[model samples]
Target chain A: EDKVVQSPLSLVVHEGDTVTLNCSYEVTNFRSLLWYKQEKKAPTFLFMLTSSGIEKKSGRLSSILDKKELFSILNITATQTGDSAIYLCAVALGGSEKLVFGKGTKLTVNP
Target chain B: SAVISQKPSRDICQRGTSLTIQCQVDSQVTMMFWYRQQPGQSLTLIATANQGSEATYESGFVIDKFPISRPNLTFSTLTVSNMSPEDSSIYLCSVRQGALTDTQYFGPGTRLTVL
Candidate 1:
């Protein structure tokens, strides 16, 4: 079975602090790694990392994949209350339409 | 990316009563996936809904318990049969625009609380 594991299940940080969330996976055929942020019901896309060492960023959030290490990390800088949410990491297997997901990291950013 | 919508954003149902959740995408998608999220837990994929064929269920999931129908490319439905308190969960629908490596967009989700 394909599995994705995330570190630091939950974290609380003050405003302006930086946080890093980690994700590691074990799959048969690797395709891509995806990040998402869930505030309420739906999960909004954050980034998709396919190659190693190449970073994907959006505003205060950035992510990178290390295929050799079989892991990925998401970094949030200058955090704000609005950044409080569950961050999810998912890996897509080659030749499959399903996504294997990590348990996620619940981030609480206090102002 | 696609705009996805789910019906009955939330509901409280009695044990043994079944519920059918609907998912609609703004555009035609080749692949639609169903997932379940229990309280304080991550999402678990249930099945992949094909546009003109039967839904492909994952391990530990069965057609009798979670039947799915994809009448067209833009719409699908998932029915939770013989429900119990254990079946209470947040059900979500997602779509992949192009290849399997493409980003998946999720619906608002149906929150079902079985009592």
Candidate 2:
């Protein structure tokens, strides 16, 4: 079975704190890894990491993947209350486009 | 990126009833997928709906319980049959565009509450 595991199921931090969320996967024919921020019902796309040792960044958020170890990490710098949301990690298989998702990390940013 | 929309943002249905959720894409797409996220759980792929063929369901999901239709590239529907309290969940619709590595854009989702 394809599996994706996320650490620290839930986290609470004050504004301006930096947080790191982790995701480790075991998939067959791995293709790519993706990160999404879900505030409500819809999950918004964040990053897509296809190569190892490379980092993808968007403003205060950045992510890196380590294919050898089959894991990825999402880092948030100076988080604000607006950054409070569920961060989801998913992996795509080579032959199939379907994504296998992790349980997700629920982050709470207190003002 | 594709703009996806789902009908009936939410619904409260009685047990033994069925509800069909519709998903519409702003542009043409080759693959559309249906997913279920139970309260406090992660999203689980229900099936993959592709035009001109029957939907391919994931393990633990069957066509009879969650029938899907993808008559065209831009639209699809998922019908949940015989609702039970256990069936209460958020149904999400997603579409894959461009390449296999491309991100799948999702709809706002339908929140279903079965009583």
Place model 2 in a CAPRI quality band: high
TM-score of each: 0.98, 0.98
Segments of candidate 2 deviating more than 4 angstroms: none
Name the 10 consecutive residues with the lowest summed lDDT in model 1 chain A: A92-101
Which candidate number would show the highest DockQ if scored against the true structure? Answer: 1
* Residue-wise C-alpha lDDT for candidate 2, range B1-115, written one tens digit per residue: 8899999899999999999999999999877899999999999999999798889999999989999999999999999999899999999999888764458889999999999
In the order shown, the candidates' DockQ scores are: 0.86, 0.85
Pairs of residues clashing in candidate 1: none
Q: How many backbone clashes does candidate 1 have?
A: 0
DockQ of 2: 0.85
Model 2 Cα lDDT, one tens digit per residue, A1-111: 899999989999999999999999999889999999998999999999999999999999999999999999999999999999999999988888689999999999999
Candidate 1 residue B5 C-alpha distance from true site, Å: 0.7
Native contacts recovered, in order, as a fraction for each? 0.80, 0.80
